[model samples]
Target: MLAKFLPGARGAVLPLAILLLVVIMVVPIPAALLDIFFVTNIAISLAVLMVALNARKPLDFSAFPTVLLFTTLFRLGLNVASTRIVLVHGHEGEAAAGHVIEAFGNFLIGGDYVVGIFVFAILMIINLIVVTKGAGRVSEVSARFTLDALPGKQMAIDADLNAGLLTPDEAKARRVEVTTEADFYGSMDGSSKFVKGDAVAAMLILAANVIGGLILGPVSHGLTIAEAARAYILLAIGDALVAQLPALMLSIAAAAIVTRVSSDKDLAGQIGSQFGSPRTWTPVAGILTLLGVMPGMPHLLLLSGAAVAGFAAWKLHQIERRPPPPAPVAAVEPADQSRIGYEDVSDGMLVRLDIGYGLVPLVDERKGAPLMGRITGVRRQLSKELGFVVPQVRVVDDINLAPYTYRLVVGGVVVGEDQVSPDEMLALDTGQAVGSLRGKTAKDPTFGLDATWIAPGDADAATGAGFLVVDPGTVVATHLNHALGQNAADLLGPDEVQALLDGLKERNPQVVASLTPQPLALTTLTQILRGLLAEGISLREFRRIASAISIAAQKSPHAEDIVELIRPDLGSLIVQKLCGVREPLRVMTLEGQLEGLLGQAARADTSGRHVIEPDLGRRIVDAITRAAQPLIAEAKPFALVVQPAIRIAIRKLVKTCLPDTPVLSFFEVPEDKAVEVVAVIGASQPAQAGHFQPQALPA
Candidate 1:
C-alpha cells in the first residue's frame, strides 16, 4: 500500500523524513530567531524542489531575474538593519536612544514585509501576462489530449455512428463541438489559475501580518516588532487589489461590449445573464472593507479575506468543469408563400434558387412585383447573341467564396462550376441553357436594382440554365461602377422605379453569361508580377515594362524560348542595379562560374560525357526552354526580372517592349552528339562555352 501511494518509495523516504524533522524544529523557533531559520529553510527547500523539477522538466528562468533581485535587496536591507539595531542597543539605554533603536528595528522588519508583498505582486503580474499571451499555446496542448477522448464520448451518444464515423455528420459535428468546448475550458482554466494564485497569495500575506503582529509586537515591549506585520499586510492587500482592479473591470467590460456588438441573440442573452452574478463581487468587496474599519476587527478581516479567497478558488474550478452549450443550427428558407413579403424581398439577401420544371410563382404578392418581368429584360439582352430563357435564379449578399471558384446550381441542384473571379467568369464556355445573371429589380425592397451580374454562356438561352440569386442592390453597386463609371444610386432611380428595375433585370442575364476566363488571366498575370517584385525586382523597372511583357508571353512560347528571351536582360539588370556593379560580365568573370558550367554540362550529357560536344548544345537549349515555360505562365502584365550587368541590360529592353510577359536570357555552348541541351533557371552563373575538362558530377 505504501509503495502504491509513493512510487520509488525507498529512494524518496529518507529525504522526506529528514525534511519533516527540519520543518518541525524550524516551526517551533521563537519569533525573534524565527526569521533566519524560516528564511534558510524556505531557501533550501525551494532550491531542492527546483533542482528536482529541472531534472524532470527544465524551466526557462530568464524572466524572473527582476523578482529575484528585488527579493535579494529587501533581504539584505532587513538583515543589515536588524544586526545594527540589536548589536548596538540592548534592552537598557537612555529613553531617547531606546526609542531610536526600536525605530531602526521596525525598519528592518518592514523590509521583510516589503519582500513578501513584492514577491506576491510579481507573481500576479507574471500570471496575468501568461494567461493573456499564452492562452493559445495552452489550448493547443489541451486539444492534443482531449481530441483523442472525443470518439469515446461520441460513441456514448450514438452506437451506429461509431462504426461509420467518417460518413456520420453527427461525428463530424461532435468533433468541432468537442474542440470548441475544449478551447473554452482551457481558456477558463488559465484564468482560474491566475485568479486563484493571486487570491491565495493575498490571503497568505494577510495571515502573516495579523498573526505576526499579535505575537511579536508585545514581546519587544511595544518596541521591536511594533504593528509592522499588520500594517504591511493591509498596505500590500490594498495596493495589490487597487492595482489589479482596473484590469479585472476591463475584462468584464470587454465581455459586455462584445455582447452589445454582436447581432447573435443567444450570445447577447448569455453575456447579459452572467454579468449580473460576477458584478456582485465588486460590491461584496466594498462591504468587507467597511467591516474592516471597525475597532478590534483586524482578525475578523483576515478570516473573511481567507474565506473569500477560498470561495473564489472553488468557483473558478467549477467554471472549468461546466459543459459547453449546443451548436447553432443551419438557416433554412420557409416553404410557404405567406412567409414571403416585401420586407423579406431585399437585395443581397441569400435565397434558394430552383430550376425545376414545376410551376414557380411569376408574381410574389408580398413584394407587390413580378419576378418574370424583372428577369425577362435581363434575359432578352443576353439572348440577343444567343437566344434562350434562364431557368432559375438565386440571390446572395456576399461574394467571399473560395479562390478561383464560384458555386453553380441547376434545377435546384448544384452542377459543374469553376473557381474564378467575376471577370474570369466571362472566358469560360458555359454549356447550353447555363448562364449567370446580376442586377437589382423592383421586387427588391433593400438597396433596389444596384447589383452586379455574373452568368455562364450567352444570356439568350435561359430554359436549361440555373440561377443563384444575389442581393440586387449589392450587384448593381458592383456592376454600375464597371459599366457606368459611377455608383449604383447615381446610375439607377429609387427601388420602386419600374423602368430602372426593368433595365437592371434585363442586364442580369448578360451579366450571368459573362463568367468568362479573361478575368482569371488578368489575376494570374498580377500574381506573377507580385511574385517577381517579392524576389527583389525594383518597382520603377517593374512598372516601366510589365504590360508589354504580358502581351508578348500570351502566345505561349516554348519554355526554352521564353528563358532565352528574358533571362540575360533580367539577370544582368539585377546584378548591376541592385547588386551595385556595372560591366558586360562574361561567365569567366564570375566567382562561382565553374560549378554552374559543370552542372550545365553534366545535365546536358547525363551519360557522363567528359568533354563538351555538339549534341550538348541542343540539349542545353532544350533544358533552358523547359525551365522558362512555368516562369512565363506565372508572370503578370507588370512583372520584371532584374539581374547583373549584361542580363540586366537585356531585361530592361525586353521590359520596355513586353511589359506584361516574362523576360529570359541566352548563352551559346559547343555542339556535340554525346551532350543534350540543358537549362539553368534562377540566379546561376553562365556555363563555360569552351569547357572540355573531364570531371565527375557531385554525388
Candidate 2:
C-alpha cells in the first residue's frame, strides 16, 4: 500500500518540505507545532549522528553535504519560528511558548533564568570553539590533499589498465570513484562553513530574542521590569538550548566524518579489532593497576576500574592463545543421489607446479624452501625480457606423483616432469670434471646434461673437481625458466599484444592508435609479435616496433612479411645484445654451395615451413651445430648469417634441433658494425671474409 503512494509522493516531498521551512520563517506557529518541530530537530540530529558513526569512509556518505545544508536551513527556520513565539507570548508566562520550552527552562535549570543562560553559553562555546573549528580545519586539509593526489591516482589506474591487470569497465569505475572522492571532500570543506555559520546564528538569535523580549514585554504588554526580565530571559535561554543542541550534534558528526579513513569496517568494528591485541591491553591494564594503588587515589573506584581492565586483558589474552581450528574436510555427496552443476567443473591454472608430499618442504617458507622465491625471480626476469607479465606458477601437492617428483604444467597440459631429492644437491658434469663421485645418476631437467644427485657435503668436492653443483631448488627453478622462455611465443596472445600497444601509446600514442584496429587487427599484431618471439627476439624496443609495424602493416597484413621488414630496423639491438657494444660480431656464414641450394629450395617452398629435403635438412642442421660447437663451448653468442630468402626457413629448422642458435641475414647486419666470419658450415671461405678457417662439410 505504501509502495503504491511512493511513486507519486516522492516528487512533491522535497519541494513541499522546503516550502514549509520558508513558511515557518515568514509566519508564526502555535505552541503544539513548535513542540513537534523541536522534537523532530532532535530526532534528525540523532539519526545523522548514527549514520556518520556507521560510515566506513567519507565517500560512503557522499550526500552528507547536501543533507547538512538542508538541516541547517531547517534549524534556522525553527530558530526564526521559536523567537517570534517567545517574544509575542513573554508577558503570559514561562509556559506560554510550549511545554517543551517551559520544561527546558524551568525543569532543566531549576527555574533559574541566569543558570539557563550560563548553561546555553557553555554548550555554544563547545560547539563553536572545539568541534566546529576542528572539523572545518580537517575538511580543508583532506580536500586539498585529495585534489593534489588526483593526478597520481589517475596515472596509477591507467598503468594498471595498460598492464592488463584491470579490465576497461573496472578502470572506468575506478576513475569515477577517484573523481567522486575529490568532489565529496571539496563539498565537505564548504559544508563545514554552513555548520559554523549556523552555530553563530544560534547565538545571535538567542541574544536578539532576550533583549527584544525584555523591551517588548514591559512596553507592549505592560509588565514590570523584574517580571519582564524573568519571563523573557527564561524563554530566550530555552530557545537557544533547543537550537544549540542539534548544532552541537551536527558539529560532532562532521568532525567524525572528516577524520574517518577508508576501511571495510565501521567505527565500532575498527576500534574493537585494532585495540583487541593482548600486547596492547596488557600494558594498559598494568598502568591502570599501578595508578589505582597510589595513596591519594579514590581506592574503591580506581581499584574497581583496574580490576575490570585486568579481566578484559586476561580474556583477550586467552582468546589470542587459543589454537586455530583445523580446516573442515569437504564431504563428497553420493554421486548416485547428487546432481552435477557448473561449480563442479573448473578451469586449471595457466602455469602450475605440483610436487609430491615428501617434496613439500621445497615450497614451504618456514622449512627454508627456495623454489617459491626462485620462481618469483624467474617471473620478474622473464616479464622484463618477454614484454609481458608471466602468470604465477601455482604450486600444489599432488599425491599421484612419486614422492620425489614434480610436474610442470602449462595451460593444463603436462610439459615437463622430474624427480629430485630435496635434501641432496645435483653435481653436473660440464665435460671438464677432474674427478667423479658416486650418487644416483640423472639428467639435468633444464639442459638434459649428465648429473648425479650427491650428498650436500659432496658439493665442495664436486666443485673442486671442476663440476658445476646446484641445489634441487635451483634445478626446479632453472627448468621452469627454460620452459617459459622456450614457450614465450605461446604466451603472447591478443591480451599481451594489447598490453604492449597500451604501453607504447603512453609514449607514442598517435602511432599506436593509428596502427591498432585501424589498419591492423589485434590478432594480426599478436601473430607478428609471436613470430618475433619465436626467433628469440625481445619486444622491449616497443617504440621502434610500433613505428615500423604501422608502416609495414599497411603494405602487407601477413605476419611473416612484417617481421621480415622490421628485422633489419631492429638488427642493431639484436646484434648488440649478442656481441656487446665494442667487440666485432663473430658470425658464421653458410658456404656458397649450401646458400645456393637453400635459396633455391626456399623460393620453391613459398609456404616458408619446408625448404630443404629431409636428408639435406638433417645434414645442414648437423653442419651448423658442428660449426657452433666452439662458440657454444667458449660461452659466446653464435649466429648463422644466410640469404634473407632462406633465413626464415633455416631458423624454423634450427629452432627445433638448435633452439639457441640465431639465424641472421646480411641485411640484418648493421652497416656501422664490423663483422668477422668465424667458420663456414658447408664449404671453405675465400679468406676475404675472415682469418678463421672453415672446414668443408657436405650438406
Each model's lDDT:
0.36, 0.86
Candidate that scores best on TM-score: 2
TM-score of each: 0.22, 0.79
**Lowest summed-lDDT stretch of 10 residues in model 2?**
684-693
The digit string of per-residue lDDT tens for model 1 on 578-624 reads 21232222111112353356445545654432344435333433333
Q: How accurate locally is residue 283 in candidate 2, as Cα lDDT from 0 to 100?
A: 77
Candidate 2, which segments miss by more than 4 Å at Cα?
A: 1-41, 56-113, 134-194, 208-236, 258-265, 270-346, 430-433, 498-512, 541-544, 591-610, 680-699
- The regions of model 1 sitting more than 4 angstroms off are 1-71, 94-657, 668-699
lDDT at 15 for candidate 1?
A: 62
Model 2 residue 451 lDDT? 95
| Cα lDDT tens digits for candidate 2, 114-167 | 999889888888999899999999999999999999999999997665444566
Model 1 whole-model lDDT (C-alpha atoms): 0.36
